[model samples]
Target: MLRGIVEQEGISKEKLEARQAQIQEEASKRFFESASQKASSLETMTLKSPALKSRRRVLDDYDSIALERILGTSDLFPISYLQIGLNAGQSICRIQIRDARGRSLGYGTGFLVADNILMTNNHVLDSLETALDSIAEFNYQDDENFMPCPTHTFRLDPEQFFITDKDLDFTLVAVKDNPSSEKQPTDFGHLQLIPTAGKILEGEYVSIIQHPKGGPKSVTVRENKVSSIFDDFIHYLTDTEPGSSGSPVFNDQWVVVALHHSGVPDPNKKNAWVGNEGIRISAISTYISENYVSYSATEQRILTKVFPNLKPGPSSSSQADGYDKSFLGSNYIVELPKLSEEMENDVSRMEDNNYVLDYTHFSIVMCRSRCLAYFTAVNIDGNQAVNIKRSGDSWKFDPRIPESVQYGNDLYAKNDLDRGHLVRRLDPVWGDKAQQANDDTFVFTNSSPQHKNLNQKIWLDLENYIMQNAINHNLKVTVFTGPVFRSDDMVYRGKFRIPAEFWKVAVMVRDDGKISATAYLQTQKNMIDNLEFAYGEYKTYQVPVTSIEDITGLDFGNLYLHDPIKDRETIGHVIVAPEHIKL
Candidate 1:
């Protein structure tokens, strides 16, 4: 009976053990499932942030194989062509096109190519079509009589396309024969296409010829880098716009590599066209070859005209293989020669756009963005003064002189009417040290409106006089000058600053009583001529140094002036030098 009881207990124990094992398996599976779901949730949360993910994908996509493969060849190298603004008196050709409808539309500009063919984006033609279909009147700025009509017959490349799927948007058209005696075709010449034979390394310099969407269409040249490549397409993180579509992409060699397609426009940002992609020309080389078989003569002619200087096929790579610290993103580059030791030394002390000692005039000035203003930097003169002279009716303090005015809490010119410094602030001083401050000094606030002619002529004389006089006499002069805004109640960073009724400048001297100054009224470009004819007398007058204080209402009482004076140094003070001492 005892043995039977033992056996029954052992079986019950075994059954309980099996139930616990099953429960443990269920718990393990549930834990793993919960962990995976949580991981998925975290990923979804991360994708919710657009700013973080937008640029992130571009960088990552560059690592993919498809992008790497396409940009890896010498056949896919980039080329760039330069563009000059039309306003600068550059030579250009206007192309007019008409579609099935007879209505007129806007015209397009043809970039110079070597062959007889002219090049423009396909969309330009489409816009011409829409205009013709609408029977709209074409508006032109330069030639009012010029109307939109198909002046040149052309053929669109069958190889070109508007891609929606794996879209590589580009349209290549052939140039037609033009009659002689017409406006010379703007055939700057053709550029060699970049080859795609080698790997396009990251951060490579790339440029594009883009058309900006605006009143008059223009070809804008911009440069950037190959941020990433993906699925047979390379993405450029360049600034492009809607009208830039179907433009050409080139590398440093000035060769055409890809056809510009589309971009991601940042609606919230101005002038922001991001993610411009291009159709890899190498990918469709066969199509280009097959379609142009019938137009071989035309293709050859176009090629010859576009690139008279080039032989088709892969060209030598002028592109630098490694990092170039000297190169910036390719939009603009400074190519100024190195400065002299003296200029370099002084520039180091000032901010970018900050004025250095005007050796011509004994004063300092700041180059605020668009405007340039003068500051006082005077010193004591020890020698006895002579050659005191005057030219006007009488040496009197004229408070009404425009130079006597002040603006934005800064008193610039006290008696001098001529706007003094131009090209203020030495950019070289800051090289790389706190560039923003250097840039900020260029603000137009630091500048005053000055007559361009006067700046180049009479003002130039005054500047030279100051520089020569200071150097010759060993005189230390102080100069303070700025602009006079229209409003008396002006704001410097939102706080109100009072200004004088008219603009003027004041120069104080340490030498025996001789004061040399000029003053005049401020006027716009149109009114400058009239103001000059009226106030031109002020430009020739020479007033006493003591008269400056009375006119400007500024007291520099008992202060010794020096160009570079040590602390606690005293130059004896006396009344303004007599009329004879003023030079």
Candidate 2:
């Protein structure tokens, strides 16, 4: 199958030889370095072994010992080895690759590397579409009585999490949970890929569990020997067929050492195989660590679960600090919006009477009764802004607050509602701490349940226009955003009320050093009420800061004076475009 792929790709023999030579050179370098380290350890042990034991005296007579007794225990393994190997085998699965129409492409081996995460060769499930079409079949082998065991199939969810490297020949993708199945992926524990070296030495016996030729599960236990070690790969003498790609190469203790990927052809003989090569687990771990920050919030969360040590530094918000009221600048002071006297007790607050949940460059004030934020405030430094891409969504509850007081995935699951970011993700994502700010926006405290169309269209456009205006002019802007909670708001799932109207107040300093504050309101009430309908349109209107305060029961202090629409006799000015904004 590998040969067929190579032929189809039109890879020349010269190219293969050059790649082989490069691998060999790297292997040789790694071998010598490892050899030196082993020699040093051996020397130290040789020097210390004698001192640790008593001095040997010349024996007058030697007891006769049977050769069978010595040989019997020399290479013997403990009874637990079989049990450990059997448990590890459960994680191994046959990957059935298929096209869009469900036609069989081929098969490869894969194993669970983390909860709901499967590891396989990139060639087997190369792209997101391929993974979507493929399925992981567990317990595809016969039982002890030679009868076929019931198999469980799971679909790959690359949309949730997927990271692959072609050169490394490894791919990690999320597997959809199958709770109704007789056997769950969690039943078979995952193999943690340790990054440290010294799991096995060259010439040591290794083992491989694979689905060869897409056949039943099989194990070549302790028959394969590690022949060479490289910085990123290892060559081992093993009986691996085409379908063995992505198999886990294990040490005697069942610890995964490498990911089996390809075979090395015998140079002197035609159509003959010498040994197989695998990407070292340590190398894969290094690759993941280096590129972790580039992944989306969902990917990062999954990776952090797999590798706990890879979690980023603690969030600045976790320290109980509030928003920097003077973040815009010392000269331009924009204080935090104040809640009305009757609404003050409805918010969560600290011992200092501060009701803000501070993050990297933003803050939030949670509404206890609504289980969502009353408002979010952020300081945007357009000059220092970073162009971070939105890959995936993974919202988490803030640890400082009670989880019960937060509306999480349950509120938006299996619905058209979207978890809208109150403080736009890209707004606070600026300066040196951009990534932290990006992650900070994913908390449930900073999100509200919004209709899909409203969140994706005009509402989103208005946010982009405001943010882009600040960036284009290199101006610093402080924005306050929140949902307008109403007593008549619709109760969702009988748990919490979903806000129909949302509002934003953007404050910026003009060239003349005068403060310019603008307020806008958008409602998805029609969409929320008519969710069964295929389509519903939302309206966005520019309003006075005082008007927003009246509905939200919040005081913007002197921001009302800076509002350009404060003197308008009418309530709202319907905005159709950027030119329609009353700045």
Candidate 3:
């Protein structure tokens, strides 16, 4: 009983009962007072309670039709893409000219057609006919095993030969049956042979067949339209490359039209297909019909199936003679578009061979003049076309910079990467001016070895900033940023090379009464550095954009401008006091 009372039951029943009653009474009084106060406060309350809300528009900005089109289009179009010297099945052929004794004469692939008789360029047949009296030989085969050159040779009938055509590319030969000793000629299906006289309309779809080096060996087809046509020649806008020569061009029906011809000797711009041209079939068809013998049953059957109901088409687009205006100040330079992927790959391979260096894409103009320098993720199109060298006591785009040295001073520097440009050279233009923009564009200090992602994103933003803010205001700016040190081979070096992916962007702006500079050295993924190195603080170093441009002889008027910073200010210039450099 005593323990129960001690355990909160009250020492004694009477006292415990009294204490509990007293506590209950006091609690009720306090509760009533508190309730009254809360009611009064609620009646007098003014501020509203917080609530969730959303904007009215959600799907307004989207284009349903465009989205559907992109998602629904069929993929049949990419099949027809072709390059030169390649065959209809996207394979290359080996022209084997040999004697009856199986002695070899010459070897090459088919190129352009001269007349009705099949014609490979003269260069292809040169070795076979080196000595006219040397028994004429002919052997032909296709690229089956990806070998650089074919081994075995079969004799070609001397009677198969006709005098090669002049002016136009033409070769006449009698069709012959396969020897009992060898496998039958590889069938490339039927080749669509369209006459040049066929309706050559501007903007009409066309296809090509050829084997491209380093790509597919089977016949590949691609489609494109005629950008423009000339009286002397026709220029279509389809993408083509080396080894595509001798490839056939056709209409949608797969009827052969023309032969893939040549490309610009050298290219420096991006996506480097400097526009593909082909040989007109009309120029050589008459000669082929008159001199070459008829195809065998097999050949005839193939042709009939491939070119059913083939007929002459008209010159659809009017001749583009009167419209051939000057691209820039009477310089007869052909206005080739940016480089194509195949061309870029070729240049990259060539650069690996030490034949040239390429850093062609436009980059930021960080700092110019005597002490000019900049950065980018990759130096593009530098030496792929024109020879590039480091200007003495000056700065310009140089293709020979080793990858290591090119992207040094940053943790992410390496080889085989692009040093992209934040600002484009063509963005700035005085007026309706069209030129190479080389003096302004071909500067090295405006680059930074970049990854494909950030280069296309943040770098593009930086370009937009300069273009909208600076150039529009007539304020000239120059920027410079690039990767660290690495190899010099543009192609090989790009494979394993690291990137000073750390973009150290520095911009110099020249405005009224002042010069300004600002910089941002950061990454897209990690806001901070992973290792022990403290993130290099962004430092804007500037003197004057014009002063530097004057010293360097670069024209910055054509550079796009963008100035959206909070306050216009100057970056540090190399201001050595008169006596600062002296003893």
Root-mean-square deviation of each candidate, in angstroms? Answer: 28.5, 11.2, 35.5
lDDT (Cα) of model 1: 0.33
Q: Which residue runs does candidate 1 get wrong by more than 4 Å?
A: 1-114, 118-167, 177-183, 194-196, 214-223, 230-232, 266-272, 290-583
Per-residue accuracy of model 2 over 468-555 as CA lDDT, tens digit each? 9878999888999999989899887777688999999999988887888999999988888855563666799999998998999888
Question: Taking the tens digit of each residue's C-alpha lDDT, what string does model 3 give over 421-475?
Answer: 3335444222311122223333334444454445555555555555454444644
lDDT of each: 0.33, 0.77, 0.34
Winning model by TM-score: 2
Compare the candidates by lDDT and give the number of the best one: 2
- Kindly list the per-residue Cα lDDT of model 1 for residues 1-583, writing each as its tens digit: 0000111221222442343344324423433344334321112333344432432332323333423322332323222112322221122234343344442233343333333333344344332222223211111223434444323233322222111111222333433333442432333334444223222433455666443442333443335666554434555666655444445665443345555555644445754544556555554342333222112222334433433433232211111111121222132221212223433433312223323432211233332221223233322121222222221111111011122222321322332233333322321112222222222222223334444444455444544454445546755433333333333333323432323222233233435544333332222333243433523422322333233334433333432132122132332122121221223
Separately for all candidates shown, the number of backbone clashes (residues 3 or more apart, or on different chains) is 83, 0, 131
Q: After superposition, how far is residue 467 of candidate 2 from its true place, in Å?
A: 3.6
Descending-lDDT candidate ranking: 2, 3, 1
